[model samples]
Target: MVETSHIYYGTIVHTLSVKNLEIIQQAVLVVSNGIIVKLDRNVKDIDAYISSASCTNYVLHRLGEHEFLIPGLVDTHAHAPQYVFAGSGMDLPLMDWLNTYTFPSESKFKDEQYAQDAYAKTVHRFLRNGTTTCSWFATIHLAACKRLVDTIHDLGQRAYVGKVNMDQNSPDYYVEASTQASLDDTRLFIDYTKAKAGHDRLITPVVTPRFAVSCSTPLMRGLADLAKEYRLPIQSHLCENPDEIKFACSLFPDCKNYTDIYQQHGLLGPDTYMAHCVHMTDDEINLLATTQTGVAHCANSNFSLQSGVCDVQRLLSHGIKVGLGTDVAGGFSPSILDAIRSGFWASKMKKVIERDMHGNSDYVCLQPSELLFLATLGGAQVLGLQDLIGNFVEGKAFDALWIDADRGNVDLIGDLTIFQKLEKFLFNGSADNILHVYVQGRRVSGVPDDENDLASSGDTLNHGVALDHTTKPSI
Candidate 1:
């Protein structure tokens, strides 16, 4: 029989698609070397299967009745540097907010020690919130960006970290020096990240141009070329606010609209993802779909900063991929769960507005399964990690969160249906309810390390040693 590393038996919940929430009860999942090998359900005799497989050197973790395993949440867009001021500075529009708070806070990252201190907190907070994968925007300072990459790597979280590029804009205190300097620093940052990652794709570098408003035409073109040269994915903002849009268009009068500017610069492609396409026209949406560029719907940021509400339903109807983004300081939270809640409210707000306009509730509301998909599978598709994550398919990496619905934030007062339990967790659950967070089959976050967990489990882990540096006890 094959020697497996670990086997988990319990209820498993995950999205099969945007509309399908598959729940498997009494399931046995096999993992070897951090990759799922097999998932068997409704086993009549657990002992028989284990003996038949001749499984030796395996850790059997059994979940409680109130506990279930779900795919880890994915955050498609966020600014790691902006996390320092996440809860403050929400009384202004996009452009004003950037100048007043965002720019000044990001500029301080030029100090290496400060970057390290702030970045550690940001990454740890996201991990505790069950975000196994995140696509992060680091400041333009090359050294600070490199420090962000190192912090994520050490924490064992899967991520796409980008060194922001901006060669033009109003603020002289925070903008890049020139197009050449931005391109050179970006190349160095990309090379540094690639070398640091070695054989592991856990951390990747993205080309971030901030937005067309701040980036020069030459800088945008150079970034497009750099993305092609490195075969890396690109991320940036698009049509987030009205004033920002007008200014962006004024900067490039030859272009028809905001989306056209990106397409003209060879910046729109399948390998690229844009955030907050709240004000995109039908023609622009078509351009994105034609180019196969993914969109990150940052509902929390939209609501917090008073940016226009994005119709995620519209994006999906147009066959354009959509994902959830916290957008950090603008969103006022680092948790993807907050993104899910904000997205739900935004969809409901759309329904209300439509009813007010037409006297009937014809707007579609996002179902729980769909919200789960947006937070997980949809984000994976946006990051081009659909093949590796977003679900519990065989031969895929084991990135998951163990949900204890009966503890912490959620309360099981009486007999409830499985769907009710799931809904409660989605609406009310917090990090306290996530008993364990695993990335690539390794426990990256969970309960605190204690003597009980360090105790010998079996032949595999022994002598009160930890599973790894990032591993914590899950009870």
Candidate 2:
């Protein structure tokens, strides 16, 4: 008979089901070959799995008094090239921000060396921020996109890296050569990443077009074809700002609305992810629900740009799948915890605004658990990886984080229940409270006595000081 190692003992807080938040106190989870085998609340009979002598090779990590484990966060939208530009474009609105700040900053990624440095720092920062999986947009440069993928693999993080395709209506400096060039480059990037096997199962290529304003009709169609051919996932922005919507309407005059533009081009599906639906109409919401398309709610960016709040409750009520995104640079904070808080606040603000606008209170406020679900399982579903990575199911991948809530003590004193402690962490915790990060059952961050050392390591290549602050254009 073969002997299988079992890792038992810990307080497992796994989202066993989306409908209910299951907390298994004093639980045992068995992992083998990087996948979870069994998770039981009580498994005292160790001899049932293996003999006493055979249990020597098994490793056990105890959960401290105030420590609890949760699934590793998944950030749905971020720009790998825009990490340096974070906190720089505070005042700028969407259009001018892109032209004067975002484009100029992204142009630097043409240099492979600069890209390597920026991507490595971004990935490391993500791990520190408890983001185990992210959907990243790389600059138009194919080499730069490849560099981002390589860095993700080296860091053992799961991600979808895309070579942004935009041939028309972008700034002259950042535009692609042509539609064919964009298609060819995308194919090359997909092939290159797909060819490199045995690195990590999490890294994959996604098809990303800048958006309706930047991507020509032909380019969008070609990318869609490629997506179908390769069975690749698609991600891009949609109706994020009013001005963006107006421009898209003018650019494609025949389309009924912002969502219609993508729908006409066959871009709406289960595997498609659209960021920032703050300005989407009821018809657009229905379309998203009908097609089962996903929306990434970038609350921080929406508020920072004054783009208006997303009707998150409305979207959910309409049966649209929603996830949280930092929308970094625009969002300022890399921590998805910030995104959660912003998600809550944004929904409340939206309710207030809607009540005032309609002279009646008919809207519902979002719940904290629902918001957390959006950040985790909702994000996994949006990225088309829910079965593999989202919830803490018995057979799911063991990707999670151990958060230390000892620092969040308030005057309340005394002991707190496991769920209460978790609520406190959700409401009050920051990235600093994250003591450990695990991806696929491997400890990737939070080593003892090395936090300061890890924080001091700067980017491998300096992209130079970020540009000065400017007000972004209203979307």
Candidate 3:
């Protein structure tokens, strides 16, 4: 008979209740294989169990006085093909930028070697950033989409990889030949990914249709059919910028708004995730809420491109699920921590502007705890993986990060409580401050030199990677 291994004596910080902002702490967690089996405040006769268990390999890691453990971030919106253009394209609005910069850069992914290199770099960067799960948009190139899934599988990260579909109103170099061809390729990509079963865990295929402007009615309808057939999630941009919204309204004159276009095609549902919903109207918000669709509030991308601030407080009031998205190239940072800080500041700016306009201070502002929830549990819910991954609850995957807050150390400052420290870390801490990152209870990032030296001295510690993990799978 085999006995289960337990991980005890750690300060676990995760959502204790979804409705409350309370985080559970000072807990004991037991993991078998990759999934968490139990979480308790006290384990009866832990010492005896440790000694008697046959398959048990108990590892007790005492968190440093300044260190805190939190669930790993999940990025709901990011473009794996846009890694090459990360800091460029800051000056153009959504449409012009998509054409001049994004389209041109993404076309390079058609080259298998280029796709491999860029996808590898992007996946590693995500791990180093403490992002264990990502919903990524791949380029129109089917091979490029495969490259992304392959790279993510090798990196041991849970991900949703989409083969972007666009048949019209796109640059000739980047557009697909026809709507049928686009649907066919999407089906192929989905079938191919499904065939590669356990090589990757939680690798779901998403139906991606670029956006309203780029997709014709037929293209969207066909993609929606595929979505229903595959029972997969759908992700795309919506109401990201004023110009894009205007163009979409013009293209789909019969539809009430950008969200309506998706709704008319049966694309609005629980598994649908729309990015940068900055200009959605009340009607659209209600529709999103009724359909149980999720929104990815990409604050950095919206502000960077001068897209108006998203009414996140309003969305939350409507009971809409909102998650943080880095939006990669558009956002200029792969770090979801940056996204969280941007979300907090963006909400504050919205609150101030609202107060000034109405001469009333009654408007609710986003709190730090809300922003943290958006970055973690909220994102998990948005991606439809809440049951399996989000929060540090027992039975969920043990994807967590150990942050060092010691001021003397470069990775973290040693002066804050777990909550305050997490807020400060999101606002100011760099990748250097992430002491260690764990995905599925396995240490994927390398340990720091200080941690290694301490381990030799019988002190257990964890440290993060200096650069992204670069190990690629043999194809």
Model 1, C-alpha of 32: deviation from truth (Å): 0.9
Q: How do all models score by TM-score?
A: 0.94, 0.90, 0.90
Which lDDT value does model 1 have at 401?
89
Q: For residues 339-358, what per-residue lDDT tens digits would candidate 2 score against the true structure?
A: 99999999889788878999
Cα lDDT for residue 342, candidate 3:
86
**Model 3 accuracy (lDDT, Cα):** 0.79
Give the best candidate by TM-score.
Answer: 1
Error of model 2, residue 376, in angstroms: 1.0
Report the lDDT tens digits of candidate 3 across residue range 1-475: 5432436444566664334565445555666556787776644544443455444334555555656677888899999988788997799887888888999999998899999998888888887888888999998998889888888876667788899998889888989999889988999999988775465356888999999888999989999999899898999999888899999999999998889999998899999989989988889999999999999999999988888899888888888888899999899999998898888889888878878999866767777777878888999999998888878777888787777655433344355466776666767776666766667766555344553342123222434312222122100
TM-score of 3: 0.90
RMSD in Å for all candidates = 4.2, 9.3, 5.8
> Number of backbone collisions per candidate, in order?
0, 12, 13
lDDT of 1 by residue, 222-244 (tens): 99999999999999999999999
Candidate 1, position 187, lDDT: 96
C-alpha root-mean-square deviation, candidate 1:
4.2
lDDT of each: 0.87, 0.79, 0.79
